[model samples]
Target: MAVEVAATRRRFTRAEYYRMAEAGILGEDDRVELIRGEIVEMSPIGRRHRAFVGNLNQLLVVRLAGRAIVWVQNPVALTDDTEPQPDLAVLRRRPVPYKEREAWAEDVLLLIEVADSSLAYDRSTKLRLYAEAGIPEYWVVDCVAETVEVHRDPGPEGYRDVSRVAGTATLALQAFPDVELTTAEIFA
Candidate 1:
């Protein structure tokens, strides 16, 4: 069988994404986000993905507890994209604190996505969106490849520095000093 597909792309903004969310176009359980104005559905999490994010969350809690916010699976509002949730986020400390509350883009110091099946989208789409918004740092926990790609140096365009860390290799944080993680631990 043969089929045809359009080459054009969808355009949207953070406001529009919020509207959709408010109108119930996206449900609470829907694992989707507006990336570069296009709605992208995230793959259903399996054991591996959940475990990785969970482990990272624990590590962040221990190291960045009072210093930094160990935020997990929360939406970060960005331009051209509304609240795209990342797996784990090490957020900058707030004045009053919102630990039990949800996190927004302004609260984020580092945004991380644990990618097993959606690696390309995380790399191409979310990375660009994060950089364009001047996100300080971004990390991709590559489960399939067993590596962590650290992204930093956010400018108007995108990140300027990117490095991949393998097993037993520690990846450091820019804003959160003394906090480091190894690939093995993240995947463990």
Candidate 2:
């Protein structure tokens, strides 16, 4: 029997990704998902997915401070090997962000991913990646299960504390306590 090793390709830089986006090949609404070193075509966004994202964005913006901007569907640059476009990113407001330039992980305060069908991938692959970057907070909105998986205390290995916020449970932001959002509102 012969053993074969899988070869992984290096992820493209923000500049390179912009080139591909500008090339008009990915399409306007193709639902393509990208993470560390990989570009993937994600499952189509259903109505539930859209609703959840919209609601979360509004809640975060309303509850959080004005200086903390709520970014919707933007690529958070982690490294040359990782750039995952999170669904909702609560970042410190910058004069120029995805509005002018790409937002990097350093700019991010909280990263969120709404997972319906991609729950496994979100918890396993994406979770580790975000932790590796030492993001303060990471939320995985598991639509199917109707739960919010909050990852905290990020280290090189990954997030140490994994809390499941269900029902009326709330997630308080590290920088903003007034930014209290309900688990139901997010899953709804």
Candidate 3:
């Protein structure tokens, strides 16, 4: 006899996810984030990834100090079903600290992902997620390629503008023209 059964997977809302965390079902050591109603395990940060994020954080903080808040490896509430902790998030300056309330998509000026082992996931899943959230700008620092991929002009369909800058080139955000970052410095 042959038997067939269809298996169903459970999808959780943001509130439910938070409840799980509060109830101690999820531990502090867990490297996970909610993505499109599913709990996705995040890759461990390698040396290159950590160094890249650290450098970017230093650069952005120095360049945008008092102008924007530089958040490193922190969660950004994208939607009720999605809260992703990007590698770095440049947020709008708020009267109250983010510790009082986490930054939502609307507060995000720029989101960056330093992609090495997670390059494919960052370029595809994370890209779509950020675009759907209407995040103004997104950057994927492709360590393997030694280039940065910039996405802008977000819409329901996705980012209308996508460009790649080589390691030797410089990148300037349209929103902040005064802040320019060289790819070499970022990838270094």
Candidate 4:
């Protein structure tokens, strides 16, 4: 005779995740993000990905200095159980400095992910997550294809508007229409 047993997994809240970090279970060097109440290890950044992030940061900062804040590799709390650090996030200029409080999903104007190794995850998981969180705009910069996948009009199902920008096409943020970057400059 044999007996049946059930197994269950534990889920963590954002507070618990921070507690883990405070207790030394998670370290500053650990590249992990909270996803749907689970701690997920992030993909290692490649040279191409790193270059694109730096390039985008430089371009956005120069263009939207006073208009918006360009956040680099910083975590934006999407929910009580999810906080993923994006490659870059354009945030609305607020009176309260971000140093006083971390950014929330509503603070984001545009979120960007540089995809090389994590292309699939960025497209599927991150895209859906950002959409569900009501992120106004999300961009996936494909290093391999040298293109940008733009998503807008977020909803519970996902982004209602999706488009690919390539060649000499200009990429502009919905929040700041005047700010633009051509694909040529992006790929370079």
Candidate 5:
């Protein structure tokens, strides 16, 4: 005769995740983000990832000045169970700083994720999450493939439109048609 045992897993809400951070249960050094009620560890930023993010930030800041706010590696609240810190978020201009409150999907014009090792996760899970949250535009910069995947027209099933660009091809946003950059400029 043998005895049987059952194992269960507990899922957390966004509020609980914040409480853990406030209580010092989660430290500032912890590279983690909440996704669908699960705390997922973020990949360490490599030199390539850092450099690309910096370059994009500089370009975006110069181009989008006064038109929108460029947020770097900051969390954007998606839902009660999901908060993802995208590499770059172009937010609608607001009078108050985001420090007063977290940026929500409604406030975003475009979201960019510079992906090297985390390309798959960014394309799949993160993509679905963003689409479900109704984020208008999402871009995944694939360092491995040296291509940029653009997603737009978010729907419940996922993004209705998806495109890829690389090399000298230029990328533009539907929200900011004036802002355009070539793939070379992005991955440079």
Candidate 6:
């Protein structure tokens, strides 16, 4: 008689994930993020995606100014097992510099992901993760469709409010409603 045993998987903590980078197990060039204790390889950023991120970064920095800090392509430590490097993260300005400590979920005012090819993953997996972490606001910019999907009022079940905007529609951050950007400017 033959018996079957289920395969087991090992999950790494945030410290272990960093140790992997320090020990050369994972290089800086490797586009990956720790999601629920698992290292997930991120999709390669295309030209359009890169452009959108850049535009958004510039626009946010100029508009938000001293109100918030615009962090681009940096990791926000949501939990011990979940650290995601969002494309653009609008963080609450504080006396303690980010160099001294990483941005936590609570410090995030807005998180934006420019999804050129990973729209599905961004809308589902990342959306749920941010919502569960109480990120407050999240935006998934779909490059192919030239639209922005906004998610707000997060709960354990996910975002309670979700909406999509395209064309010349004005898009504003939930935290900073005064700061606005148009879909045309985003896709341009």
TM-score of each: 0.84, 0.86, 0.93, 0.94, 0.93, 0.95
> What's the ranking of the predictions by lDDT, best on top?
6, 4, 5, 3, 1, 2
Q: Per-residue CA lDDT of candidate 5, range 91-111, in tens?
A: 997767788988999999999
lDDT of 5 at 33: 93
Best TM-score goes to which candidate? 6
Q: Whole-model lDDT, candidate 3? A: 0.90
- Candidate 1 on 80-177: residue-level lDDT in tens? 45568789877777675575655666677899899988899889878887887778899988878878888999877778999888867877788855
- Residue 156 in candidate 2 has what lDDT? 87
Give the CA lDDT, 0 to 100, for residue 40 in model 2.
Answer: 68
Residue pairs clashing in model 5 are: none
- Tell me which of candidates 2 and 5 scores higher on lDDT: 5
Better candidate number, 3 or 4, judged by TM-score:
4
Which segments of model 3 are wrong by more than 4 Å?
Answer: 1-6
State in Å the error of residue 97, model 6. 1.7
The per-prediction tally of clashing pairs is 0, 0, 0, 0, 0, 0
Overlapping backbone residue pairs in candidate 3 total: 0
lDDT of 3 by residue, 27-77 (tens): 898889999889999988888888889889999999998888888988899
What would the TM-score be for candidate 1 when compared with the true structure?
Answer: 0.84
Poorest lDDT segment (10 consecutive residues) of candidate 6: 2-11
Q: What is the C-alpha lDDT of each candidate?
A: 0.81, 0.80, 0.90, 0.93, 0.91, 0.93
Deviation of model 6 at 9, angstroms:
2.9
- Residues 1-188 of candidate 2 have per-residue lDDT tens digits of 97897986766665676678899866787666566657767766778888899999888877774668888886678887577778899888777756687777778889988988878888888888888887888989987777888888999888888888777788788767766777777766
* Of 1 and 5, the candidate ranking higher by TM-score: 5
List all candidate RMSDs to the true structure.
Answer: 4.1, 2.5, 2.2, 2.1, 2.4, 1.7
Between 2 and 5, whose TM-score is larger?
Answer: 5
